[model samples]
Target: MNKIDLTITDAFKNKVINPVYLPYLNNETRTQIYFGGSSSGKSYFLAQRAVLDVISGGHNYLIVRKVARTLSKSVFNEITKAIGFLKLTPYFTINKSDLVITCVNGYQILFAGLDDVEKIKSITPAKNVVTDIWIEEATETDYDDIKQLNKRLRGKSLVKKRLILSFNPVYQTHWIYVEYFAGKWEESKNCYSNDDLSILKTTYRDNKFLMPDDIRELENETDPYYKAVYSDGKWGVLGHVIFKNWRTEDLSEKAKPFSMFQNGLDFGYAADPAAPTHNHFDRKNMTLYILDARYCYEMTNDLLAAEIKNMIDRQVITCDCAEPKSIKELRQHGVTAIAAKKGKDSVNFGIQWLQKLQIVIHYTLKEAINEFTVYKWREDKDGNVLPEPIDKNNHIIDSIRYALENEMAIIDRPKRDRPMPKRGAL
Candidate 1:
C-alpha cells in the first residue's frame, strides 16, 4: 500500500472530517452525545477529535467500550488509524502491552474497558488526570459505568472536562435518551448543570466517506422498526412495549407534595442485576416519580441492605415475595423490610395498574428508565404480540411493582400520619 498523508489540513481537504461535527471541536459542553444511524462517521470523527485533543494542550483522552477484551480490535484500531492518518506517529510512543500511546509532549491516549474497573482506576497520566472521555458504542455500556468513568476526569488538569458519548440510538429507555432527548431530568436537581450538555444527531447522509455499496445496503433495509431507529436516528419502539402509556417529564418541586414514599427491592442471581428503587407517589394524579435507583450485580444481602440503609434508614421496603430470607435478614439489620402481596398474575396486575397512571421517572434513576424503555410484551412464535412481558430487563420494573403495592393498599384505607421511616437506624 502507498503512504497516506496524515496532516490535519490534508484530512480536512480530503473531507474525512464531517462538517456536522465542527461544533464539537470546541469545548462548549461538559457532556456531548453524538448519536445517529449506522455508517454516520461518528467513530471516525471521535477518533480524530481524540487526536486533536491530545495535541491541543494538557489533555489525555480515555477511550472506552463496555468490554475490555474487545477494545483492541475496534476502538483501539480506530484511534491508531487516525493517529497514522494524521502522520503524527513519530511524536507518540505506542505500548502494545499496555494499550497506551504516550506523546513526547507528555500527553497520552489510553484505552480501557469499563468491565475491568481496576484497570480503569489505575490509569495515571503523565501530565494530569484524564481530561476527556470518548465512549464508542455507548449503548453497550450502562449508566453506572458512565458514572465510574466520570470520576476519572479530574486531578490537576486545566483543560475543560468533557465526556463524549457516540452511539446508534438503540432503545428509548437508555439513559442517553432520557437525559438528552427526552428532557426528563432537565429540571430535577443534579450534580451537573444541564446547560453544560450538548447533543448532536447525524446520519449516513452527512458522511462523505461511506462507500456506495454500504449506503445501498442501509437504504435497502426494510424493517420498519430498525429503519426508524437505526437509519432515521429515532428512539426505538420495541414491538409492543408494556409501559407505552407512561412518559418522562419534569416533576415540578412546587407541585403538591407526594402522598406517599416507599422503597422496593428486586434481588438478582449471577450475571443478573439486583435493583432497588426509591419512589414517591402522587395519589391524586396517580403519578409516581422515581426518586432514585441502585442497580448492581452479585450484591450480598448485607451489602444491599447497607446500601438501602445509606439512602433511607428503616423505611418500609417491599421486596420480592420469594426473597423472604433476604427480607428477614434485612429486618435483622434494622431495616423495615416487608413482603409484597403476590398471587397468580401479580406481575400482570401491577403492570396494568401502572399503565393506568402517569409515571414521571427521574433521569438519575437510569435503571428504571432503561427498563421502562425496553420492557416489551412477549411475542408468540407466529410473530404476534402476547399479553405477557419478556423476562429480561425487569429488575427495576419488579422493584417498582412491589413498591406500588403500597399505592394499591391506600385505595381502601384512610389517610393518616404514619411517622416517616427512621433515619440512621441501621
Candidate 2:
C-alpha cells in the first residue's frame, strides 16, 4: 500500500494515545467513538485522522460541532493546528469561507455545525461524498439531527461510510451510548464486533501530555464533587435540581383559586412503584407547582384506590389519575379521575415541554426533585449521548412529563385582541 509521509509531533508522541486511533487512521473501521475524562487526547487523535484522510487523495471528511460558533472555536482550530504542526499546509488549500480544506491529491476536509437545520441541510454529502464524519462534543447536538446527517452521507463508493464521535460521558442514559453501544451489547449478550462499532474509553490519567502544574491543579481542587465530575469522570448528584431551584419555603395559607386541580399518574407496579404527582396550576402566576407526590410499591388496585381517596379526603388532592383500575374506582367513589394519555412519544413531548419552561415545584416534593437531578442522556458505544426511554421507574418524572404535555396547550394561548373602549376624555 502506498502511504503518504506523516510526522508525529513530540507532543502527540508523548501523549497516552489509545491504540483505537491507529485503526481509524488505517481505515480499518467505519465507525469510531472515543470517550473519557478531559485531556484524554481524543481531540488530538481525531485531528491526526482528519489530516491523514485529507492527505490520502481519495476520501473527503467532515468535522462537525454542535454550533457554528463552537466549530470556529474548537474543531476548526484543532484541525488547523494539526496541519501547521505537521507541516502539511503545502499539500492542502484551507478555504476559510466555505470551511473546506482541499488537498493537492483531491481529498477534502469540511468543517460544519449541526445546530441549525438549514445549515445541516445545505450540505449534500452526495455531491462532496464524505468518507468520514467527525462529531466533536457529540453530546451537545440533537440526536435527530445527527441521524439526518447520517442519512445524507450516501457516498459513491461501495464501502460503508464512517462516523467518528468523541466526547466525555456526561449522561449515563444518553441515546448514543445506550442505543448504539450499550443497547446492542445488552441485546446480543456478547461483545460487539468492529463491523458493529467501537467505543474507546480514555481518561485524564491516560493523557501523558498534560503539564505537571495542570495535573496538580486538577488534584488540588477544593470541591470534591467538581473534581469527581470533571477530572475523574465519576457521576454524582450536585447543584440545585431543575425543580428544586424553583421551590419556596413559605407554603402559608393563601386565597385558593377555584381552578380545576389535576393529578398525573406514572404507573410502576412492583419494584419501581407507581408515582402520582399532584400539580396545582396557578393561572395567576402562570406557574405549575408540584403540590405533592404519592409513591407506593406493589399495591393492589383496592389499596391504591384507598390511598387516592385518603389524599382527596385530606384536601391534599382534588382530582387524580392513578392506575387504570384506580381511575375507574375513583370515578365510582365520586372523585373525578382521568386516564393519562399513554405513549412513548406523548411522554417525551411532555418532558421536552417542561424542559423549555421556567418551572417551579413546591419544596415538599423532594423525590420528584431528586429524579430530575439524576436524570441524564443515555450514551452509545461510540460515545454519542441521546435521551433515554421513559419507564415506570421514573414515575414521578414521567407524571410531570404528562402534566406538562397536557397543560402546554392551555399555557401557550396567544394574547386576545381587546375591543377599544371609547377614548373617555379625548
Candidate 3:
C-alpha cells in the first residue's frame, strides 16, 4: 500500500469516523441519500467515507457536486483539508489538471461536477467499475437528470458500486421529495431505516459538532411559516393557491375532461403586450385547468381580432372578457366580449376558494407554477402567518383568480344548519 493511503486509513480510524456515519457505513443499499438542514457535517462525512473506500483497495470512486464552481469552492477544499490534516501526502499524489488522486496501490479518486446537461451526457467511466458516486447539493439538479446519470454506472462482473447524495431540504413539496421519501413513509407508516433505498431525513440536532449559537440563530431567524420546512423537515403549503389540494398532476389527469373553456385577456396597447390565458373549468370535478397562454406585443385591433377568431375556431369559448377598448373592438369584429366585473374582494375570494380545493397543474406552465410556489402570506412583526396585505410577486396568481372567479362560482355548502336563536321578550 502507498504511504498516503496508509496515512489516510489511519486518519479515518482516528480522527474522522463518527457514530453518526456508522449507519451509512453499514447500509447495504447501492443508493443512499443524506438530507437535512445546513451545517450538519454531511459534506465532511461524505468526503471522509470516499477516502476510506479509496484506501481500502477501491479503484474507481468519484466525488461530484452540482457544478465545477462549487466543487472548486467547497468540495475541493474539504477533501484537501482532510488529506492534509490526515498527513496522507506520502501515499498519494493529486493530479491537479485532471482532478484525480492516485494511490500507490492503483486505487483512483476522480473529482467531477454535473452542472451542465451536455457535460453530464458526455461522461464515460474510465473503467467498467465505478465503485462510488457522490453528489452534493443534489436538489439543484433535476430529479430525472439524476436518474439518467444513475443508469450510466453499470459495472463489470467483478465490480461493486454505490451512489451517495447529500442535500439540504428546500422544496419539500417538490416531486422528488414527495414521490420517493414522503410517499414511501406514508405507505409504510415508519421512518426509513438503513435497509431502505431512501434516507429521507437528518437534522442539525443529530450533529453534535454544531455550536449552540449557530443552532439558536437558525431557530430564531427562520420565519414561522417556513421554520417547519427548513428546520424540522415538515411539508406544508406555500403562497397563494386557487386549490390548496390541487397539484400539477391532478389537473392533467382528473380535471381535463370536464373543462368548460374560456379566455381571460389583460390588455396593453404599446407598453406591455396583450396577454391572454386560456382556461378550462371542469364543473363536475370542481377543478380549473389552465390550458394555454399567449401574448402578443403592440398589435392593432385588426390583428388581435384575427387571433381571437382563430382561438374561437379551435373551440367554442363560452365567453371572453377584456378592457373597455378591447371589448368594443371585439364587438365590432362580430365577437361578443365584455368587461369582467371583479373587485379586490371578489378576486381574493376566488383565490381562497382555489386554495381550498385539490387541483393539479401541467408542468409546461412553469412560470405560473413558479408564481404559485413563491406566493406568500403577509407576516407580522413577530414572524407569524397573518391575514393582511398580500406578499409580493403575486400578479400571475391574481390573474388566475380573476379568470376563475368570473367562470366558476361553486362554494362549499355547510352540511348542518344551526338552529335560529330563540326570540327573547322585548
Candidate 4:
C-alpha cells in the first residue's frame, strides 16, 4: 500500500469524524475539552482526532488516564479502532505490551497513567518533542496532575501543541468546571471558544448513528438527575428547578398524527441567538408537544423569515411583541407572523401556565433539552428563589412560551396529583 494515500485521506476521515465535531477539525487552542455525558462519543472523537493529527504531522502524542489498567479497554481501544476506521494500520507499528503506536516516519503516540510517574517521565519520541496530550476521564486527575503534564509539551514546532481533556462531567465542584467554567453559564451550548481554550458539549442526540434501542434506553431514564447528567449531557442541578412536568420523547413520529401545528419565535443577535420553535397542543390530554426548536446566532430578519417558512409555510407564528418591526419585515417576506400579547408579569405567568401541563420535547432538540435541564428560578443575592427564572439559557423555552400563549385560556385537563421530579441532592 502506498504511504502517500495516507497523506490525502480526507475520505477515510469522513467516516471517522462525526458531524458534530467537524467545527473543531483545525482547532489550535492550547486547551481543548471534549466533555459531556457518557456514550456521547467525546472520548472516541478525541481518539479519532488524535489519530488524524498524528498523520497530518509527525509528533509524540501522549494519551493518559488516571490508572494504567483502565487505558487498555478505554482510550487504547479507541485509538486502535480509529486506526482501523481510517485504514491507517499499515503505516503504524502498534506495540500492544508497551501501549504505543509508532509511525513509519518515526513519530510516536504514547499511552501512560499518572500512576506510572517514572514511565511517563522516561517517555521521549524518536523524531519530535511531545506535541500533544489527551487526558482521558480528566475528572479523575487533580489540578496538579494537569499542571505537571502541561509542562511536558515543552518544545514548539510547526503544529499547535494542544492539551486535550475528555471526560463525563461528574460533579459541579470538579476542578475542571471551577477552573474553566465557573462563571460562564453559556458554556452549555454546543460549542464555546476563546483564543487559547475551546469547549465542546454534546449529548446522545449529536450521535446520529446511535441505535434505536440505545436511544430508547437512554430516553427511558427515570431518575431525573441521572438522565440530566448522563443522557442529556448537562450539569445537573439538584434543587429549585423550574420545569419538571416535561420529558423528552421521540416526537417526530409521535406528533405526526396531530392535527394542529403552530410556531413561535424569540429574536436575538450577537451574544444571544434567535430561537424558533414548532409546537402542537392537545387540549384534552393536557400535553404540549415541542416538535422543533433551534438556537441560531447572527441571523437577520430575512434569514429568520426564511427559517420560519422552511419549518412550516403559512403557519401562524407568534413572535416577541418587542420586535414589532421585525414582525413587519417578516410579513413583507411572506411569513405569517404576529406579536405575542405578553402582559405584566408575562414571564411568570408563562411559567405558571407551562407548569400546569405535561411537555414532551423532541429527542433531537439538543439545545432545547439543555435549556430544559438547566433553566431555574432566579435567586436574590442572599439565595432566595425569585419568582422569575434566570434570563439566559432559555431562548428555546421563551419561544415555547410565546408559541403556546393562546392556549392558556383553554380549560386545563384534569391533572393527576403526582409528585414533581427533582434532581437528587448531592
RMSD of each: 11.4, 19.9, 11.3, 18.6
Q: Considering TM-score, which of the candidate structures 2 and 4 is the better prediction for this target? A: 4
Best by lDDT: 4
Give TM per candidate.
Answer: 0.56, 0.53, 0.56, 0.55
Q: Candidates ranked by lDDT, best first?
A: 4, 1, 2, 3
Global lDDT scores for all candidate models: 0.74, 0.59, 0.58, 0.78
Q: Candidate 4 residues 179-294, lDDT tens each?
A: 98777647436667889788888988888768899989989875555677788887666546688888888986788798797689999975588888999988888888999887
Error of 2 at 74 (Å): 0.6
Q: Give candidate 1's error at residue 301 in angstroms.
A: 32
On TM-score, who's better, 1 or 3? 3
Best by TM-score: 3
* Models ranked on TM-score: 3, 1, 4, 2
Once fitted onto the true fold, the runs of candidate 2 whose alpha carbons sit more than 4 angstroms away are 1-20, 124-128, 158-160, 181-194, 222-225, 234-286, 289-426
Ranked by lDDT, the better of candidates 3 and 4 is 4
Predicted candidate 1 versus true structure: per-residue lDDT over 270-360, tens digit per residue: 4677788888887887777877776755567887788788866777888898978888988888878899886656777677777778887
Model 2, 115-176: lDDT tens digits are 46676666643224777788887865556757876776674753357877887655444556
Could you tally the backbone clashes for each prediction?
A: 2, 17, 15, 0
lDDT of 3 by residue, 1-426 (tens): 432324334445545554566566545477787776666677777776666556556446777765554466577677666666555666667777667776666677777776456765565544435667777777656566568768766756244566777777554566657656764655222136554375746556666767999789667744554565556544444633223354565345644465366666556544344555666766666766766544444567777667666654444322224457667866687654556666445544555567655555666554456456656655656555454425433444555554565454444323113231122210
Which parts of model 3 have CA positions greater than 4 angstroms off? 1-14, 95-98, 124-128, 157-159, 186-191, 194-200, 235-371, 381-426
